[model samples]
Target: MPEHRSATTPRPAAPGAAAPAAGRGGAPGRLLVRVRERIQETAEAVSLVLDAELPYAPGQFLTVRIPGGGARCYSLASSPHTGEPMRITVKRVPGGLGSGWVCDAVAPGDVLEVLPPAGAFTPGPGGLDRDLLLVAGGSGITPVLSLAKSALAAGRGRVALLYANRDPDSVIFREELRELAGEHPGRFTVLHWLESLQGLPTAAGLGAPLAPYAGREAWLCGPGPLMDAAGTALRAAGAEAGRIHRERYFSLGADVFAQPAAPEPPAEAGVEAGAEPAAEAEVELDGRTYRLPWRRGTPLLDVLLAAGAPAPYSCREGACSACCCRVLEGGVTMARNEVLDDADLADGYVLACQALPLTDRVRIGYA
Candidate 1:
């Protein structure tokens, strides 16, 4: 059985490999894990149990590289506080190569190439003890369940879930949630919304059920419409905008498993002629610190990779939080940030792929 704990212990890169780029799978920063089991959660959803004991927080996701198909991120539903195998639930999307392959073709005993767990979706420092409001729709329930279980088992907070689904039979983790509720009757509450009976959820319609959780830390995941409505409803019910965190689901459009392109020259990439030397950045990654000259107008990830630093990243477009790092000293600005919420920004977290140095002598760490 996998060790269960609330704190994450970093997993070493696959033996004989380096960070993000060189791995046993012939790709940088990939690991090969065997499928321990395959579970059908619903008609369109399946959960794959991996036979590895690496550490990961509740809401973090794994980037799995399909053999012929590209990479796709799937949230881990298994709680680190629970003695369950590392598992990721995948729902087959109408023509999605990654989700479709994981759900329909992958089977027990198959080997998969995956990037280690990455994302800033996990609870922040001391966040586990705060009351939680989890709003999930469709397959968004995947990460929601993980956070709920982790909190119930490891924290002192009350947990409530407002889950929306297409219909009764389409609710993933139905029995598991019931068991959880039974285990912690006073600490756990679940409100279900079935579209077949209630029609599509609207902000006005969700106000009643979401009002009770308005004061709690909100974590929203699901489709665009559902998340938007939930956010609106929460805010209307008095939830502070900074207290609401969200995880957006999107398919990776770039090949994360491929080698990254060479960084452009500082002078060619629009550095001022004979301007003050580019800001200096001290990057802490994989237990080593490297100082590099971060050119203006260049993303931090580009600077790190160019200097042969073993930083992990996926989807340089900044939609995914795979390249998240924290600023310990100076500040940086993100060109585009689709994942981090206001709370994350307030906590000094930024997407390295989108970050440009805002001050000289910046220091960032990825622990």
Candidate 2:
């Protein structure tokens, strides 16, 4: 019988002879950043810079967490090349908890926790060597400005920016964008759109046909209706579907149009108005179950936190999917879900921040 090779024998390494260590999967990176400066961009909007180095892509965003209040997502408005400092522009929504904290309580030298960058809105490879068109409304100019700055810094010259705001004073990064336009000369074009301009033309009135940049990539970000209008017009004017990218801000007004109608509850499961339930509900999260007092009309998230369960969450308005969790058992009614796709929802994924427990017991996990 022929001698059999030992199956358990380890292979020998080459001259370098180094072994690879196990990779840490999905570990969170935290940064402590102090506010370096803050400027009022508008009556309700402000731009802030941090004395910290945050490595991030052009269109990526950071989650700004306040001490007592929750966190909110803000797009990075400055380029990485600026070095050692990161800047983000924020627009305070009326009655917003996070916005009010950042505007009123946050000050220079105040330190805050910043999560690592996360987003899928960055520019693509096809954007290379093509004339770039950017359309922004209100505070949506943040990410667009970052992309433009990155492209210019990389020596990718052909670019144009069309920024729209309520008025000239509300335009974020006004001086910096103007300086960039001046530096690039004919290469960069900026169209300022003001709804209240007495004699000036609006973005819709710009007679310049989009045919000149037929093969160009277009980026749009703003309020839902404005972004929709700009995207529709760009497509109608011959911009390719694959080349047009967009991002939308959270809007209570647009939620009606953006969200699908919620499913109605069964007659047998009707909740009594102004009457506290006899018993509290329990939700199982991360191997621990917490009981929450059954308060009428209380959101599921509030109940979870009140019961001492640490659930991951950002942008409690239900727009961002950061707090997404999978329902293992039972049902929940979502007030709104702007981030999850149909396939995700079908897979039992739900935004824990927006969900209301429809039953006495629900099981969820941060899968």
Candidate 3:
């Protein structure tokens, strides 16, 4: 064994060890953190260093709740491998609730509540020896940066980033990305595409940079069009069909979560106009079944939670697939889907957070 170091000394990781996990331990819940430091990345982008010690995977996100500004999910911006303060980047928009408050108001030592990190857009614990291709747009660079840094920090594989922005002035983490490329030498590379300077991005334009990386799996996060175009290009260029993964960014306003509203039943059995039928559910999880009161418009996850059923969920905006479950019986209607490719949908899978009960009696099982 190597000689023991003092308490203040930061020990090195064991040889061949992978980077720290990209997700925190245990189930998701609300956590309070003190703002330790705030670094401005651009006029609109800011990175917050939280005092809280959270064990989260790269590409995961936290749903932060501002005291009076409501809650919204933002991706983790720092690498867990560095053991530095956990950080999140926010690009504020005018009239925005959470982002605006965090960017324009919060400061060091201020306390804020945040939900535990929850997302499946993470690279697994497996030895990431394979090449990595990262494509990001606008604010989607947050999680991509984390994953790239973690992969480089672990000294596991080559990482390439193709970042798109409106202009050079609007690029977030411009300096950090340059520093990363410089420090890592040949292991890490980055390409910037500015719409104002290079015209709008195209499949051929983005595909050209990816040609050199013959055997790389891609992770995409950005606007729908960019992701779709890149996916098409990569697939056309012979990249494996399922090798390109994507994470969509959702902008939910004052409504932290959009729950399908259940109209209050009338005191009398005569009922009121537009009232939905009294629906019920049989939800199965952990080998047990629970009967719950469900309404047509109410989200299946809400109904399960209200009736004390153990249903897991995070980032109710539908971007994160934490609430996904299989509909075993009856029918459900999903309001939105940022996750779940066509195959998963064809398999009768639905996000419980966005799915509404369509039939009077339904059965759902966690997948």
Task: Output the number of the lDDT-best candidate.
Answer: 1
Model 1 spans > 4 angstroms off: 1-23, 261-278, 295-298, 306-310, 331-335, 340-348, 358-360
| Candidate 2 displacement at residue 256 in angstroms | 24
The alpha-carbon RMSD values of the candidates against the true structure, listed in the order shown, are 5.7, 15.5, 10.1
lDDT of 3 by residue, 96-188 (tens): 666777788889988766655555566654535667998888888888899888888874789989898999988899998999999999899
TM values, all candidates: 0.85, 0.61, 0.70
Best by TM-score: 1
Report the Cα lDDT for candidate 2. Answer: 0.59
Residue 266, candidate 2: how far off, in angstroms? Answer: 36
Candidates ranked, most accurate by lDDT first: 1, 3, 2
Q: Give candidate 2's total backbone clashes.
A: 0
Candidate lDDT scores, in order, read 0.78, 0.59, 0.69
Candidate 2 vs 3: which has more lDDT: 3
Clashing pairs in 3: 22-56, 22-57, 22-58, 23-56, 23-57, 24-55, 24-56
Candidate 2 per-residue lDDT over residues 184-270, each given as its tens digit: 888888878786783343335543634455467777777657666666667667776756676645422222212222222222233
Residue 126 in model 3: lDDT: 56
Residue 151 displacement in candidate 2 (angstroms): 0.8
Clash numbers, per candidate: 5, 0, 7
Weakest ten-residue segment in model 1 by summed lDDT:
1-10
Ranking by TM-score: 1, 3, 2
